[model samples]
Each structure stands twice: as C-alpha cells, then as structure tokens.
Target: MHFDGSTWWMFYDGTSRGRRHVGLATSADGRSFTRHPRNPLVLDAGAVDVQRVGGVWVMLRESGTGTLWSTSPDGLCWVDRGRLFGLSGASTDRFGQVTPHLQVVDGVPSAIWFGGASVVSWNRNRIAVAYPDGAPAPAGSGCTACVSAGLSCAAACQSALGATGGACGMPGSTDGSRCCACAPEGCERCIGASADCHAACVSAGAAGGWCATPGSTDGSRCCACW
Candidate 1:
C-alpha cells in the first residue's frame, strides 16, 4: 500500500478457483477503499509491491512460476516485463519466495521477502534481503549462512558467484540457508536455483532456445534464459 498525497492506494490479491489475481483499490481517507474499475490487474499474480520510479509506476508481483514486474504510465494500464527472480536453491528459499516488499532508502533500493522450505509452512520460514546491484552494504553484513568456511551467505555468494546480495538463518533454528542472485553477462533475467529452466523451455518448445545475461536490464541481480 502507498499514499500519494491525497489518495491511498492498495494492491491486494484474491483467490478464485485456486488461482490468484491482483487488484487495486483507492481511498481518500485511507479507510474506505473502493476497488478500481479495472480490478484484477493481473491474473495468476499476487503479493504486489507498487511504487513510483522515475516518474513511472512500477509494480512487482509474485507469479506462481516466478516473480514478475510490470510498468504503467497512469497506474491503470500495465505492460508485463516478465520474470524478475524465482526460487533460489538455498534451504531458506528453496520452496518459495513469498511476500516481496521493496524498500528505497536514500536512493538505494532493496527487496525483502520470506523464504521457506515449504510453501505452506510459515513457522519455519526466514527473512531474506537482497541488494540486486551488489552495492552499499559490505558483503555479509546482515544474515548468517549455512555454508562452511566461516563465510556469511552474502560473502560466499559474492566470492563464488559474484552475487549482489544474499541472506541466511531462520527464526526458530539455525538450519535455514540463504539464496543469492547472480546476473551473468548477456542474460536478461536470472533463473532461481529451483526453477526447471530446461523443462520449461522444452515444454514451451521454444525455437530460439535460450541465452544467459550477466546483469539485469533494470539493475536487479538476474540471469535470463531467453
């Protein structure tokens, strides 16, 4: 939810027949919100985080397949930009990356989310953070890693994969691990460790095959198979 001077905007998700849909509502007093005429902005998407970036409205949503991003000129009409990041292979986020929230501080942007081994189990979940660009925070500043060699999850990611950010540890136990995003050259997006890239491409029967990118077009840590 965001407040733009006179109005408060809320983005929420609802389920119909087990499918998720993203919707928008607005209110002047931040209490009684009315759904927008164009409700359900996107299908099979939820956990939306909306913000204004460079005078344009940017929305990030968690699609079942992956996290997707879109851009809107008037905040009503949007154009899909495809997957942002998906399941990292780490124990903390192996099964899911849920409830993504974006925070911008002093012109720097970071994304935080819950990582869990089971999509339905919240008690064993852990909080994860990512910088995407690998800037500002020195490696291994926050969370701990499950890896060996005394390397924090973030540090290990940076050292081994040149990852921008990573986090580790869980709320109740020390079993949780961290996931990192590494944007490789030429790739437009990054595939999470758990994503079945080969199977997805094969199922889609893409004729152009796929390629990997070193960095994300939007400055996020990403690798793409296009």
Candidate 2:
C-alpha cells in the first residue's frame, strides 16, 4: 500500500475469476477503495510491488527466475519495462528476488527482498537491501507530498530541461516537483537524473549506460544500463 497524498493506492495479490493475478484499488480513507475496472493489473505475475520514482510509476512483478518490471502513467494501466533486478547468491540463486519492496531513505531509493539458501535454507529467510552506492539515509523514509501520483510537475520539469539534463538528486530537485535525470548513486527504488546520476553510474562502472523514462516520453527517467 502507498499513499499518494489525496488518495491511497492498495495493491494486492489474489485470485480473480479462475486466474491468479494482482489487483488494485483506490481509496480516500485507506479502507474503502474503488476497484479499477481493469482488474488483474498483472497476469501470471506474483509478489508485486509498486513505487513512484522521479516522475514515473514502476511496478515490479516476479517472472520466471527474475523480477519483471513495468511502468505506469496511471497505476491503473501499465507497460512492460522488463526485468529490474536478479539475485545470484546460493540462497536466492534459484528463486531470484522475492517479495521486493521499494522505499526512499533520505533520498536514495532502496530495494528490500526476501532471499535464502534454496531448500537447504528452507524457512530461513534472509532480508537483503539494495541501494545506490553513496546513498545517505534516514533509513526508509521519503517526503510524502514530494511527488504527485501522475507526476505532472516532474514531467514538466524534465521536459523543460530537455536531454542531457541532470538528475533530480543533483542538488535541489528532490522537492518531488521535478524528476531526476538518471537514478542516484545508491537508489534502490527511484530513477536518477542523467547528468549527475549517469556520471555516478559511469563512476560505478556503467560507462555506456542507457537512461530513459519508462511510461511517458517527458524525459524524466531512470538509467537501465547502470
């Protein structure tokens, strides 16, 4: 569940009709929500998690041995963005990352998932946290009213900056009103700005990284090559 200022968005894993899928609902009070007419927001995908980064809304769903990701303009509709992360340790080598969640600590986006040694570590779940390399933290928190649900302001800000723009995390863009150029150095959840974040990526070894926004063409996006 995530709070988008005025409305609360709740995503759940359940069965509808005869198929197992993910569902969504919106509510003003956080208790009652109007189900989206387009039910089964995701098909055959489970362990769903949703987050808003820069000005984009991203959905992470488990697919095969890795996690599949998608971006949405409105949480109701989605477009595939492919795999976001994969696990390689002995415990999670087989199952990949499971039940991942995104949170912005201080400013960098953080990813937390459940992993452990295959059957040998059965029932012994290990919690892993992934984030940008240089992220400073208040540890698991972000400004609530920073970014809007549709991210209109972020889109506009990025559009105004054009290509070769710096990330929102650069210096003064974290008001949630503008989008980042690429993802920050240690962001596990959010996308960073291109000028700064990309530099960080290159410094981190993704010299030829490719960065783009997922849903909208506004240019407010994250770096994938990194």
Candidate 3:
C-alpha cells in the first residue's frame, strides 16, 4: 500500500474462476477503502509489489510462469515491461523466477525472486537477483556452436533448442558470436556425436531438422527437428 498525498492506494490479489488477478483499492483516511471500478486490474498476476520509483510507479508481480514488471505514471494505468528475467538454465533455477520484489540498494534497483529446479518442488529453491541492466550468466550457458554462428546468446538458445527463452552465462555479452544458456524443449541433446546433425535427425525419423549446436567433434550438441 502507498499514499499519494491524499489517497491511499492498495494492490492485492484475488481469485476468480480458478484464476488469480490483481485488484486495486483506494482509501481517503487509510481506514475506509473502496475498490476501484477495475477491481481486477490485471489477470493471471499475483504477489504484487508496487513502489514509487523516480517519477513513476513500478509494479512487480508473479505470473506462475515468470516474474513480470510494469510501470505506471499515476499508479492507475500500468504498462507492462515484459518478463523481469530469463531462465538461467541451471539445475537450480532452470524453470523461471517467481514471487518478485523490487529493492533499491545504493541507488541501484534490483529484482529479487525465488527459483526452483522443478515447477512443483519449492522446498529446495534458491533466491535469485536481477538488475535493470542484466544479470550474471550461468555456466555452460547454451550451445557453443550456435553462439559461434553469429547469434545472440539468447537467440541462439531459443532458436537452437526451441526453448521459450534464453540467458547468457556472462556479463557484457554481445548479440553475435556469444554463447548463452537455454532450457531445451522439443529438441534432443547429443553427446560425443560426430555424425551430421540433419542426417541424424532424419535417421531418427524426423521430417527435417538442423544442428542447433554444430561443429562439435567430442562434446554435447543438439538437433532440432520439425
């Protein structure tokens, strides 16, 4: 909850039809409150945190899949800024981040969230941090072959592995000729395979495919087939 001089605003989560939503309420005396006409300001969002940053309002929420960020000029109308962070591709946080909180330390803004290895296992999770600029990339980020082919780390992972998104394992990573990390889906990772990736896919009964990570003689590579 925050106060804008005269009106106190509160953002909360509510469930309707088995789905979570973000709601807004306002109070004049910090006691009696009224719900905004747009009660559920956002759909499929929960665990909201709103704060005044510089001259605008920043809102962070967990969308189950990942954490999302938004900004508002008056705290009433919000503009989504997309996913707060990308998958690190680590066994600890391979899925995504959730339950986000925005904190400013030494004049630098950062996002804190919880990441778990699996979607259902929360007992053994890790707290992760992400900055406005970016976060540190994880180890073995993505296919080295794809990165060598002049693709952004994230793009390499996404296009090569057919993943939802990707992240790099290092800072100041450029778009071309840099390796990143990605969670593979609808793809197969081959270790110590020297055969042609496309032929291997065809041999495996795929209609057509490409070597997501090519040019590896004795290492892990991936084959993406359609």
Candidate 4:
C-alpha cells in the first residue's frame, strides 16, 4: 500500500472465476477500499508486486514459466512488459517461483522470490534476489574471470570450465552469474565455479557422460554402472 497524498493505493491479488489477477483499490482513510471499475487488472499471473519507479508504476509477477512485469500511468491501467530475465531464467523448484517481493539494497532495485525442492522446502526453498542491473552489480568485486564472458549460459559455463581444464559434453543451466552443468542420468550434476559436467561425472566415478537437459531439476541420481 502506498499513499499519493489524497488517495491511498492498494495493489493485491484478486480472484475471479477461479483465476488470480492483480487488482487495485483506492481508499481515503487507508481502510474501506473501493475496487477500481476495472478490477483484476492483470490476468493469468501470480506473485504480483507493485512499486512506483521514476514516476511510473510497475508491477512484477512470477511463476514457474517465467517472471513478467507491467507498467501503469494511473493505478488502474496497465501495459504488460514481457518476461523478467535474469532470475526468471534461473532454476525453478517443483512449484515454480513463489513469494516474489521487491526491495532496495544499496540504492539498487532488486526482486526476491522463493521456490521449494523435494515437494517441500527441503532446505532448498530458493530465496534468491535478482538485480535489473545485471548480477554482481557495481562490478569488479573479485570475480573478474568472467568480465568479458559471452552472454549465453552455455558459453559462460564453457569459458569458465575450460579455463580450469574442465570440459562439458553438453549445455548447462544458469543461476544468476554462475553456470551449472547437469549431466545425464548416470552422471554427477555439479553447480559451482568452473566445474564442468564431464569433469563432475569423472570426479563422481562416472566417466564419459552426457550433459543433462538444460534447466533440469533432477538431483544427483547417478546410474548404477561405475
């Protein structure tokens, strides 16, 4: 809820006909809100969060598929702005992404979202933050190995892994700035700096393995053959 002098604006998730959408309401006393003539301003999206930036009102909503945003001049009208990159492309747990919120850290706008693993949090409920200004923002903070790396997740993974004498037999998944190599069913999946999928396989005793599918959420289920 935010106040614009005379009217108080409230943005919330409103349901109608078994669908969740973003809605806006106005109140003069911060209570007793009157829904806008056009309720359910947003359709087919969840995890809606609203904020005003540079005199423009922006709304963010994310799900397993991806994260997206919209802009509004008033609080009621909106213009959808495609998917939210960066964190949106990151790994998603079984339930997609959840609890998306916004915060300003060190004067930078960031989005926070959560996702769970193993049907439950399983200590893997992802509570990660994404910065619109690229990750590791403010730059030049120790990790310069990727200063001029390629933009694709696979390229980044290959460059970093190759530099460490590691080779990936296939593509990898991206999480923020780091790339993780997910090998086939009989290989070890590793997510860390300069770790290649093939290297991880050999390290885990599964030699000459194939890379797993991109954005694969399958855990380390190695095959029974040494």
The candidate scoring highest on lDDT is 3
Better of 1 and 4 by TM-score: 1
User: Which ranking of candidates, highest lDDT first?
Assistant: 3, 1, 2, 4
lDDT of 2 by residue, 94-176 (tens): 44666667675554466445442222222323444455455433222232234333222333343454332233443334554
Instruction: Compute each candidate's TM-score over C-alphas.
Output: 0.57, 0.51, 0.52, 0.52
lDDT of 1 by residue, 54-156 (tens): 6778787653444568889878888999877776555445556666766765644555443433233333345665556555443342333344433456545
**Model 3: ten consecutive residues of lowest lDDT:** 186-195
| Candidate 3 Cα errors over 4 Å, as ranges | 105-108, 115-124, 134-226
Better of 2 and 3 by TM-score: 3
Q: Provide the lDDT at 48 for model 2.
A: 85
Question: What are the per-residue Cα lDDT tens digits for candidate 3 across 24-48?
Answer: 9999999999999966777777778
The deviation in Å at residue 22 for candidate 2 is 1.6
Best by TM-score: 1
Poorly placed runs, candidate 1 (over 4 Å): 63-66, 118-123, 136-226
